[model samples]
Target: MSKINHFKGVLFDLDGTLLDTIGDITYAINSALIVVGAEPITTSQCKGLVGRGLKNALKGALELKNREVTPSQLEELVPQMLGSYHRHPYRHTHPYEGVEALLDDLAKEGIALGVLSNKADSLVQPIIRGVLPTHSFVFIRGDKEGWPSKPEPDGVYAFSEAVGVPVDQLLLVGDSEVDYYTAEAAQVDVAIATWGFRSRERLLEAGCRNLYSSVEELRKEVFPWL
Candidate 1:
């Protein structure tokens, strides 16, 4: 095992890291976009924009195919989008294959487990509970009103503090630029989850050094102590 994997805790980004939530996100986005006379986005298109939180994700999806939604239109549509997601967050959402086993192995290693996402705080727990009921995480937080999301270090700092783990001793595992920047800002090591939303090329372009291609690979590298 690499020395960097010897972490006190492992913090994950929910959308791309822990769960394959792109389908539901795409569906909700399209459902809401149609309400404003906009075109729908594909699941692939939604993957690239999944982790940036509500507004950014919506904006990216709206503009994906040269389709545009003004700030005013987006603001007006936010509530409908939120409501759609809240009502059907788990319609097509599920953990990446072997994620449950990977989480179990990490638990056996006696390391703290946490989830920090740009998804709404209220939505995070319910989605987790529905999709990953067996895994026990110590910290599951999403974008609370006052806290900045990932790529800003605020969420990472909050996770470290909440879990009582030193920033350097935590492994931030994710699959997007936001996740990469969060680790960079907080001065922590990162493991790129290849099975998540974005492309591996994008992660590599962003200078990701640790790439976990599968759950078995993740178990070997990140929780080998088990």
Candidate 2:
């Protein structure tokens, strides 16, 4: 493997990547489903539904319920779903173990960090600022009207531009296949976090060659290079 310092900047995926917001998300979606008279899904099902953005998550919920809801109907349902989610955003949310220390170490090393998330911009910023206050992040990309969400590379490119770094020097760290594919599309190096949402086999199938089983492993394999 190349030395850790070889990477100049790192981009992170928010949901399932840096923090576990599953509880809030699952509750919100399930509540929406129930209110809309669709079947409610379990937290386990919700976890798999995540990472593709709120709209996709809702679609997954409908799929699980075996209900066919129109896109227009799903759109109408989004506001209430998100409102319920924001009400208890941090109720059961927390960083994965060792994330804080690893972030601290990276900050101390003067590495540039950024976040790109399918999470709406409204939510991504506060969640990150609330969770990791000490370290300075170069940029963050959240859902904006009409902006393509991941597995597309636009957000990655935006973050790279904001950080004034080439995509080649950027490393994307995320916990899902969406993150891996986004990095691949953007032509950046990637690290799949096993500590997040997806399984090791799934990550491998998604074409993620670099995998970190723990935050400490990330610190060892990636921090030194940054």
Q: Report lDDT (CA) for all predictions.
A: 0.83, 0.81
Taking all chains together, the TM-score of candidate 1 against the true structure is 0.93
> What clash count does candidate 1 reach?
0
Question: Could you tell me which 10 consecutive residues in candidate 1 have the lowest summed lDDT?
Answer: 1-10
Backbone N/Cα/C clashes per model? 0, 3
lDDT of 1 by residue, 1-226 (tens): 2465559898988997888888888888887778867778888878877777887888887777566767788888888889999999899988888888778877887888999999899889899999999889998989888988888998778878888989878988888878887888888888888888877898888777678788778777666666
TM-score of 2: 0.93
- Our model 2 lands, by Cα RMSD against the true structure, at 1.8
Worst 10 residues of 2 by lDDT: 1-10
List TM-scores for all candidates, in order. Answer: 0.93, 0.93
**Whole-model alpha-carbon lDDT for candidate 1:** 0.83
**lDDT string, candidate 2, 91-160, tens digits:** 7888888877777767677768888888888888777777777768888779888888889899888887
After best superposition, candidate 2 residue 178: deviation in angstroms?
1.1
Best by TM-score: 1
